[model samples]
Structure formats: C-alpha cells, structure tokens
Target chain A: MTVLGWTRHRTNLPSGVRSLHCGDWTILVSDDPSIQTARHRLAAQVSCFDAGLDFLPTAPAQNIAIYDATSFTRTTDLDALWRKLSDRGQFSVAVRMAADQEHRTQDGRSWLKTRQAQRQRQRHCGTMLADIVAHLKLPTTQPRHTENSASCDVLVQRDDTNRVHNAMQHLARLMQGPPDMRLCVTGLWPPFGFVDLTSKTEAAE
Target chain B: MSLALEMATPQDAIRSSDTALVDVVDGLLRHGVVIRGELWLTVADVDLVFLGLDLLLASPDKMRPEGITR
Candidate 1:
C-alpha cells in the first residue's frame, strides 16, 4: 500500500499521475480521468446495507489525492470526493485546513494579536482533531503526510469500516447542531452510509 | 457593616481556562466538514469575535516577544 501526502502545491508526483479537479479540490490519480470519471459518475451512492463493502474501484498504483478545505461548503461535496478517492483504491485521505494568518492585516499591532489568536486556534484545532479521531476510533499513530506552514492536516485511512462509520456519524451529529457547532466538520467529509438525524429536532424547535 | 468573601477553587480555575472545550471550539471553527447553507448572520459569529477578543485580552502579557515581560 502506498502512503498518501497532502500539501498546497503538488509535490513528488509519481510517473503517470493524472491530475483531477474535483469541485474546488485537486487530486492526482494513476489512471486516465475519462475512465475513472465515468466509473464514479455511474456508481450509485452506496447505502448502509452495502456499507462494509468497497463498491468504488481501486485507484491505480502511486496515485496522490489532494483536497482543499478553504473552499469547502458542503458535507456532500466532501463525501463525493471521499467516495471518488476510495473508489480509486486510495485508502488514506488527508484533510487540510488553511491557517487563518493568511487573512491577517499587515498592521503590526493588530497582526500580533491575530497571530496569537491564530496560534490559539491552531492549538485548539490540534486538540479537537485528537478528540474526533478518538471518537471515530481511528489509529493515532499514522505518519504525518505532508508539511504546510499555513494549515493543519488530519490523516484517515479508508479501510476501517467501523471507524469510518463512526467518524461519519459523529460528523453528521456535529452538523446537526447550531451553525457555530457545525464548523467542526468544516473540512471533513461525512462518512459513507451517513444520514442526518438532527433535521427532525431542528424542525420541531 | 460586614461583607462575605468567596474563595476560588481548583474547579473555578479549570472552568476559566476550559482547555478541552476551548480546543474543541477552536477545532470546530478552524477545521471539519461543513454543510452549505444560505448566508446569513448568526449569534455564533458575534460570540466568536468577542471570544477571540477575550482570549486576546486575557493573555496580553504573553503577547510581547520573548524576554520582554510586561
């Protein structure tokens, strides 16, 4: 199995890697896009019954998948991307969140404050990622995929059916909460076989 | 006239920093999967701005560069 890495600009491309733009994200696969795209577009969304089975086709060898969280707006968008990656046989997926410092103003005094705030935010993100991983029962010892100064990456494998299910379900629950709470799932894709259970509560409220 | 004084406890300190909750909130704000919805202002944004300012104010002494203690 090949290990996956994540970064802003593409790096260490393997021979025969094909770049694919999935929504706002970009990825490099080993096979041709025409074949992969048609296969994924035709595959129906796998339901809970077929949850454990890997319905999507495996990605060709030495494929690199990249997703940008800055422009992510929907959980389904992420799901589709994850499904595509999974289908291509890419077991490991890295989700990256752009650092807030990029949006800082140049004023030194204010910038200092923003940087401090951003650091605090980054630390918090690290801790929360820890919690989510724990909740999803994912392994904690996965190697770091890539290094980026402006963002943090959380690496998850696709093979663990139970862990993937837990992660997806936990994310769906988080999304059901108020908007502020919903931000935690911002860069993650909901797991396969996920259903929104909070809509009824919201509607009743 | 007399006034009663309350003593601070360890619990109070933990509650003040709220390290875990703060980290979770920070993570939610900074990362995770998001659902697209119609754009609108919500109390969360207002609260987050104030929370950031509060955190900034609380650690003003730590804001300075190393070796420059206020």
Candidate 2:
C-alpha cells in the first residue's frame, strides 16, 4: 500500500482515504497509484490535520522532531505571509544554496583537487546551515534529495503552522550567497526533517 | 528589514527558478519509499518509458555520491 503520512490520532478523512493500524501512530494509506496525486492529497490535507504536518517532499532521511512555534509579531510582510499561509496551508520552507568551495588554509590549499574543493564547499555549506538553523531557533533536517551544495535542502519550521517567512527573510538577509544562487521560498511542507517516523515496526525488524 | 522578498505558490516554483509564489513541495519525492516499477513520461510530445527502474523517489541527499554522507 502507498503510505500518505503518519499521525497520532485519526480524524475525518475524505473518501478514498484509508488507514493502516500501526503502534501509537495511524499510518494513512491509499490505493491511489499516482504518486503526484498522493503528493497533492498530502499537501492539501496537511493544513487540515495535525498528522499531515510531517511527511515527505524530498524530506530528509533522518526523522527530526517538530517544535512548538513561538508567537511572532513581525512586519507587514510576515503578518501577511502568515495569513496567506493560514489560508493556503503552507507549513515549511526550504533554503537551497551553493557553497563556496575553496580551501585557503596553507596545508588544505596545497590539495586543491576537484573532489577536495567539492568536499570543502560541502563542509562550508553544512557549517552555514548549522549556523542559520541555530539562529532561527527552528527545527530543521537536511533533505536526502539534496544533490549537491547547489541544491542542499534545509527545512526550517516554527510554532505556527507555517509562519516561518520572517525567519526566511532573516535567513535571506543573512545569506550572502553568490549572484547566481537563486533563493526560492516554498511552503505548506512537513518538517519531515523534524519528526521521528521510526515506529515499533521498524524497531521489531 | 525593508527588503521585499517575493512570495510564490508552489506551482510557480515548480520548474522555474525566479518566480514568486508559495512553494509547497517541501520534498517533491517520496522519502524512503522506493517504487520498483516502470515509468511512462512525456516531455514536449516525447513519450519516454523505462523498464526495471527502481525509483528511490526521495531527496537527492538519498542519492548522495558514494563515500559522501550528509
């Protein structure tokens, strides 16, 4: 069966949706063969149900826990974004970027191979990600789909359903990336980076 | 900060890099769900099909190069 998401409690679901009884969590499943259809269904349901908040959309491999969102009284954009997010049900945002790949240290600089440079850049990207995540004070997970430094996915979350644009703005301002790096703020995403999906079944296996 | 960053919907952010709409595909691929099946896709009137494709539909982080861990 194709799994949609896992929730702690069961709720009113539209027709064609079914559930799989798993430990403390309710695993939502469906017969829909279309993966795209499953995605749209999941995205639409996230805002409606608490269980839909954490799932996969190029989610990180690890299960990161979701955190309580802090009350925010920011500017007009954030306020508006929150309202829009509330209406649209956008819950998460991803910041993808390319890191600078250079080893300036004397010994490190000596080994300026292609792979070494790439590794250095990846390290820099990881460091930058940690710093940003720390400053935002939000839960985040590195997406497994991240192909390279150019497409690293850092899922940021907050207490409000998806009222994390201000954090995004702050993140954007703090990001002094290259001109070619384009920052796209996408939403209503599960902090798939934020919740541990490991259930008793996995442990039993 | 007075910097007006554009807001976009997920649909607009799908393929293009510079459009402002809300992007909601947090992870467009299914995480940890590998569909071992065939694929039929069309791009610009071109129909493409693949057999025996083990679809590890998730983040590229899953497709990390050998010896590299994120």
Candidate 3:
C-alpha cells in the first residue's frame, strides 16, 4: 500500500535562509555562506544531470528558474516575466519573507510581533491576489471556506490554455510585489495529496 | 531556450509597497506542499548543534513515496 504524507519540521535556521520547494525544485534563499555552498552544489548537480534528476529536471519536461526579487522594482518587470512564462505552459510559484531582525530575536515581544506580522502578511497576500484576479478578469469570489482570510494557494486549471496563462501571469506578478518577499515558481504536475497509489499499481498491471 | 525571465536590476520598483511584500510572503509560505526536515551542524567534521526546522514547498503528489500516503 502506498501512503502519501506531508511533513513540516522547524529548525533553528541561520538568519536570512528561507527555502521553497516547487514540484521537484527547491529554492533556498540566504546570505549564509554554508547554505550558499549547498545551493551552488545543488545547482551544479542539476546542471550535471542535464535532464534534471527525478526531483529537479531540466527544461521541456521541467524548468527551474531563479530570480532575485530584490531586483524587481516595477509592475512592468513582473508583467513581462509573467507573459514569458504564460507563453510557455505549466508552472507554479511561491514567495517568502527574509528572516530579519524581528525573526532573529525570538522573545516574548517578538512572538506577539510575529502574530501581528502574520496578519499583515495575510492582508498583503489578499491584496496581491485581488490584483491578479482583476488583471485576469477572473471571478473574484473568495473560496467559501476561506472567506475571512486570504486564500494563499491559487490553483490554475489547464482546461483552457489561455485561462491557465492568465492565472500564471497573475501569480508571477505577485512575486514582484515586495522586496522582503522571497518567491519561487515551478511547473505544475499531478498532486501527491490526491493520488491513489493502489489505483496506480492496479492500472499499471 | 530557457523560459526563465531575467529579473531587472534593482530599481525604484524594488521598494514595493509594504503590503505587497506581506502578501508575497503569506502566499509563498501559507499555500503549497510543505516538507519539513532537519540539518545537523558539524564543527571541524564533528557533529554538534542540530537544526530541526526546515521547509521545502513542492507538489504534494510528487513528494510521496509508494508506501507513505496521507
């Protein structure tokens, strides 16, 4: 029996290092020297494979791209990138915040500050999503369950390629939103969460 | 040809609105398939401090091995 699970573990990560994984690609953001070495090694490994290993593959099948959000200074910059990616096909993107002074000094006060920060982050995400939806001219209805809070995850279906491109463009624009935001994007594939291993095995036979 | 878009060099837009940054962070962290792992620090090849928190976001479907499903 194949069982699939998602696990989250928290560690005392060195300041400034944040990691985002999309599909088989992993993006680590940090100024830490050791972490930088790891990132370089990973990049080399991906290049060496040429076809990208099972997890991180090369273009055509899989394309792993990196961008420094700090450099993106305009909405146009984001729009151009979005158009480029949309011209392609499947993709996914993720954004994160740099671990700064407030994150480094974890104390009682910081805990409260973190909560406030989370609220602010959610609001920002909402604004970005709203902007994207408006740009794509898609329905702006909030998912029923998450009506109160911002819906962090935006799933773009591939039924119609044009619609998919609009969704992807909107997401790309979101990545260009803020300097502190660390973003990573990847091409989409079947989700492990909903896959049935037993059914797969039976089908193969 | 790489479809990857080249992010322009830092300019006025780099300093986007605070709300924008917050939203980016929220979406990146909150939405996605998160995988957690740990890193053990070594000093002079000697294993020392253990860093227990790390997250990697990806498609949840691809991360699962055959035997583990949740």
TM-score of each: 0.28, 0.46, 0.30
The Cα local distance difference test for each model comes to 0.30, 0.41, 0.33
Query: Rank by DockQ, descending?
Result: 2, 3, 1
True contacts kept of 2: 0.16
> What is candidate 2's lDDT per residue for A1-205, written digit by digit as tens?
3344444446675455665554444555556555334334444344333433333221222211211011111111223333322222333333344443443445422433433445444545445555555675643544332323322234443355344666767766767654534345555444443333333333467
TM-score of chain A of each: 0.33, 0.50, 0.33
Off by over 4 Å in 1: A1-106, A141-163, A171-205, B1-70
Give a tens-digit lDDT track for model 2, residues B1-70: 2223344544444444542221234344334444444344547854443233555654454454221122
Give interface RMSD for all predictions.
Answer: 23.1, 11.9, 14.6
Against the native complex, each candidate's DockQ, computed on alpha carbons, is 0.02, 0.09, 0.04
lDDT of 1 by residue, B8-60 (tens): 22123223454322332232112123222222233753312222222122122
- lDDT, candidate 2, at B61: 40
Worst 10 residues of 3 chain A by lDDT: A1-10
Ordered by lDDT, highest first, the candidates read 2, 3, 1
Predicted complex 3: CAPRI docking category:
incorrect
lDDT of 3 by residue, B1-70 (tens): 1122212111211234555333332332222344434455657865555444446564543333211122
